[model samples]
Target: AQSVTQLDSQVPVFEEAPVELRCNYSSSVSVYLFWYVQYPNQGLQLLLKYLSGSTLVESINGFEAEFNKSQTSFHLRKPSVHISDTAEYFCAVSVNQAGTALIFGKGTTLSVSS
Candidate 1:
């Protein structure tokens, strides 16, 4: 069975500080990884994804994640975070087959303070 693990349930960082939301997984078959974020009082949004081609992917808001095959991980990182970055982030996976459901991690809450 494949599963995604988000070790850190909460990450509190000051404004303009660096942050990394850890995400790891175990899978026997080829899969696609994604990071989803939900802002305050809003639905979940697709932050970034890794399906094929490059192992590393980035979002417009200066967030990036790398797909490490051997390590079986897709950790999201940002050099400097802003107060606006505070939100709930989730790591998700999907099988290549069409109409497949996505498996998501517990989710990590990022709290950015000024």
Candidate 2:
């Protein structure tokens, strides 16, 4: 079985300020992890994914996440965030084996203000 947790339920920041949303996962077998973002009035979309090879992955919009196997963590970070960055961020994990389950965190709401 696998589980995901988003440490902070809400993160408020000013525009252009750096921010981070922490995520942690646990699984008995190999798994693939991803981050998804949900903008206000829009559905969720993929932000970044960690499949294999490098432990670091990034989104086109300046968001980045480093998968740390030792810590079982995949925390998302942005050096400079804009107001548009405000949204709900979700951390999800899927087991590699067939019929395995996909789990998602409760989600963290990031509120970026001007």
Candidate 3:
């Protein structure tokens, strides 16, 4: 079984400030990493993924994360956030094979104050 842990449940910051949301995971088998963002009252959308080849991945909206195999962590970060970036972020993992469902962390809500 695989499990994910998000260190922070909520993080508040002023607009245009930098932020980081920590994530760690453990799996008995090889897995793919993903970060998804959920806006208020909406379903999650994929932000980025670490499938293979690269340890670092980035989202279009200025967020990035690195897959650390030794530490079993995949932490998300953004250099400068915006009010529009306020949302809940989830770190997830899925086995490399089909028929395995994605498992998610509880989530970290990023509140950007203007």
Candidate 4:
């Protein structure tokens, strides 16, 4: 079984500032890590994922996450955030095999203020 934990419930940051959301996981077998963002009243959108090849993966919107196999961590970071980035972020993990369900974290609400 695999489980994800988001250390913070909420993160408040100013517009254009950098931010990092911590995520940790535990799994007996190899797994795939992912980051998803959900806008208000909208479904989750895949931000990034660590499938294979590289330990670090990045999204188009300035978000990046590195897969640390030893620590079982995949923390998300943004060099500069925007007001539009305010939303709920989730860290998820699933078995490397297909047809497995994703186990998500509680979620971290990112509030970007001016």
Candidate 5:
């Protein structure tokens, strides 16, 4: 079984500031890591993912995450945040096998203020 843990429930940062959302996961087998963002009253959208190949992956919106196998961590970071970045971010992990369900953490709310 795989489980995800988000260390912080809420992260408040001023606009243009850098922020990092800590996420850790535990699994007996290899897994895939992902970060999803949910806007107000909207469905979750994939921000970035670490499937294979590179240990580091990035999203189009300046968000990046690195997969650390030894530590079992995949922390999300943004060098510069905007007010529009305010939303709920979820860290999820799924087994590499097919038809596996994703196990998500509680979630971290990013509040970007001016």
Candidate 6:
């Protein structure tokens, strides 16, 4: 079986500060890791993903995450976040290349303050 777990449900941070959101998974086989951000009522947008090869991956919007095999974790980090970065972040996993249905966690809300 494959499952994803997000350790934190919320992370409140002031604007321009660094942040980290923890994500862990349990899978019998290799899988794909993905981080998605949801702005308010909007749908989720892909923040980053780890497919193959490198254990580290980055997003265009300034977020990055490293895949840890032994820990079965993929935690997201950002050096500095803006108020606009406030959103609900979801961690997901897919078993194989099909990558069709993604198993999503409850979500971690990153509340960026001014």
Give all candidates' CA lDDT scores: 0.96, 0.94, 0.95, 0.96, 0.97, 0.93
Model 4 stretches with alpha carbons more than 4 Å out: none
Better of 1 and 6 by lDDT: 1
| C-alpha-based local distance difference test score of model 2 | 0.94
**Per-candidate count of clashing residue pairs (backbone under 3 Å):** 0, 0, 0, 0, 0, 0
Off by over 4 Å in 1: none
Stretches of candidate 6 off by over 4 Å are: none
TM-score of each: 0.98, 0.95, 0.97, 0.98, 0.98, 0.96
For residues 1-114, what per-residue lDDT tens digits would candidate 1 score against the true structure? 789999999999999999999999988999999999999999999999999999989999999999999999999999999999999999999887787889999999999999
lDDT of 5 by residue, 32-107 (tens): 8999999999999999999999999999989999999999999999999999999999999999989889899999
lDDT (Cα, tens digit) per residue for candidate 2, span 10-69: 999999999999999999888999999999999989999998999989899999999999
List model 6 lDDT by residue over 1-114, tens digit each: 788899999899999899999999999998999999999989989999999989989998899999999999999999999999999999999987563689998899999999
RMSD of each: 0.6, 1.2, 0.8, 0.6, 0.5, 1.0
Candidate 1 local distance difference test against the native = 0.96
| TM-score, cand. 1 | 0.98
Residue 47, candidate 3: alpha-carbon lDDT: 97
- What would the per-residue lDDT of candidate 3 be over residues 30-111, giving only the tens digit for each residue? 8999999999999999999999988989888899999999999999999999999999999999999977799999999999
Query: Model 3: number of clashes?
Result: 0
Clashing pairs in 2: none
Ranked candidates, highest lDDT first = 5, 1, 4, 3, 2, 6
